[model samples]
Target: MDTDLEILLTNDDGIDSPGFRALHDALSEVANVVAVAPADDQSAVGRTMSNEVSVEDHELGFAIGGTPVDCIVAGLEALGPAPDLVVSGCNTGANLGAYVLGRSGTVSAAVEAAFCGVPAIAVSLHIPEEEWPREPAVEEYAEACRATRHLVELAPVRGVFEHADYLNVNAPIAGEEPAPMRVTRPSTVYEMAATQDGDSITLRDLTWETLGAGEVDDPEGTDRRAIADGEVSVSPLTAPHTTEHHEALDRLADEY
Candidate 1:
């Protein structure tokens, strides 16, 4: 463990959430962990930022009345010393697949950190919808907390950031035994549908229903597939968009 390493801990779940506390406790054991997170739930808000956000003092650290991205910026710039790494989540639900990466506030916090030139990791747990209303026991997040801590210990020293800007991690609810971890890629499968009523329409994400039935059909080496197999999935990702020269565009430019 790098005692000198400082970690900025934030989450889409509010600062008071058990998931956030679980991660804070787990990481505090290995590094200097500072919690700068939303005062209330900000899940699925992505990288949305407010020009000015309200900040308040909290037991763990500071709470921002804004999105996860706001917490990252505040933590890095004002709440505390610049962190060696930024870790987000132990999120209430798994942020799986390529489609959700941009929609998850937990992952977005890490993305914001990556753009700041710091390595980051976003962690989430795949809890069945039925399990969400109840307060999850700390023991329930054991596997995810452990996986997150292990990654925090290894990523910086192992030069993981040399190739990837950030990592997205998901774990199933902990069982009696620890789950195995797998390096994975984001599943590209996209499925969504909508239904109409008399005066309204309902948007539905069918992936969860498919996932719950053990029918995802995602191949090996994908995050969704690894999670379905009860393994911790870690997807190394880069933040910036890549571009290539286009001959077709050049020909059009010449014609113009």
Candidate 2:
């Protein structure tokens, strides 16, 4: 346990949510972990930030009445001391694939941290459909958090953050036997769908259904496939947008 090592913790789920509390308690065992999560649920809100936010001191840390990104900026800049690493989630659902990277608040929190020049890890649990509509117990988060704590312990010294802006990790909900860990990349497949009704346009993330059915031909080393195969998926990712050389754009500019 590196008591000297500090961690800034935040989540899309409210600070009091079982998953957030569970992870906070679990990581506290490994380092000086502080919670600066939202005061209310902010699931799927992406990297939205509030112009101003309310902050209240809580037993674990501060509960920010704002988005996960707001919590990160507030925590790192004003809440307390700068932390060695920033960790987001232990989210209730798997945040897999490239389609969800920008949409998941848990993942977005990590993205915000990377933009703020901090290495981050976004963690989530893949709760099976059988367990839907019920809260997962704190104990249930144990195995998933084992993967998280291990990464927290080694990632800094291992030079993982040197190359990667952040890591996106999703662990299967705990089973009698802990699942194995796998290195993966975000699957590039996009399958979002929407149905039009007279007054309502229903949007569904078809990817979830595909994953639940184990019917997705998710390729060999992608995050979704690892979760479907009962393994913890760890994806090292760079934060900034990349641009490739484009001859078409060059010709267009020349014509102009």
Candidate 3:
């Protein structure tokens, strides 16, 4: 409790979400935590950012009326003491795979923190579709929080951030025993489709459907597969898209 390591806590599910509170209280055991999270749910908003947002003081920390990215930027620059780390989630649903990386607000908050030079961990709990109809007990989030606390306390000191900008972590809802842990990579599987019906097109992400059926095509050593196997999946990642010098692109540019 006397440690100087400060943590900025947030979630795409918003400030009042049970998952958020569970993680916040858990992380508080490891570091000083500030909750600069959205006042309302901002799920699947990705890295959508706002130039300005309203902030209010809450019992846990500052609540902001904006996107997850907004909360990260605001927290790092204006809301609290500059954090040693940023932890987003204990999200109600999992955020997995390469295609999903750009569309999950929980992961985007971690991405934003990475760009701002703070190490981060984005967390989610994998609750099956049938179970999602009911809100999970706050205690169920303990499994994810347990794993997160370990990473928060150790990753920095271990020089993990030298290679990874942030970590995307997903875990299954707790059962009688703690779930196993796996270091994984994002799944390469992509399964989005759109169907046109009369006046409008309905878009669907089939990956979640595959997950619900426990039949995803994700291979071994992948985030999706680890979560599917009821293990905590931790994937260390870089943010803001890696740029490489490409002679082919240079030639195409010269032609242009």
**Among these predicted structures, which one has the highest TM-score?**
2
C-alpha lDDT (0 to 100) for residue 215 of candidate 3:
87
Model 3 spans > 4 angstroms off:
none
Judged by lDDT against the true structure, how good is candidate 1? 0.93
Error of 3 at 161 (Å): 1.0
Which ten residues in a row are the worst by lDDT in model 2? Answer: 128-137
lDDT tens string, model 1, 83-141? Answer: 99999997988999999989999999999999989899999989875554466777788
* lDDT of model 3 at position 248: 100
- TM-score, predicted candidate 3 vs. hidden true structure: 0.96
Error of 3 at 130 (Å): 2.9
Compared with the true structure, the alpha-carbon lDDT of candidate 2 equals 0.91
> What are the per-residue Cα lDDT tens digits for candidate 3 across 1-256?
7888999999999899999999999999879998999999999999999988999999999999999999999998887698999999989988899888899999999999999999999999888966765678999898999999999999999999999999999999999998899999999887889999999999988888888887877888999999888899999999978799999999999999
Off by over 4 Å in 1: 129-135
Compute the lDDT of residue 43 as modeled in candidate 3: 94
> What are the per-residue Cα lDDT tens digits for candidate 2 across 130-166?
5665788899888778999999999999999999999
TM-score for each candidate, following the candidate numbering: 0.96, 0.97, 0.96
After superposition of all CA atoms, the RMSD between model 2 and the true structure is 1.2
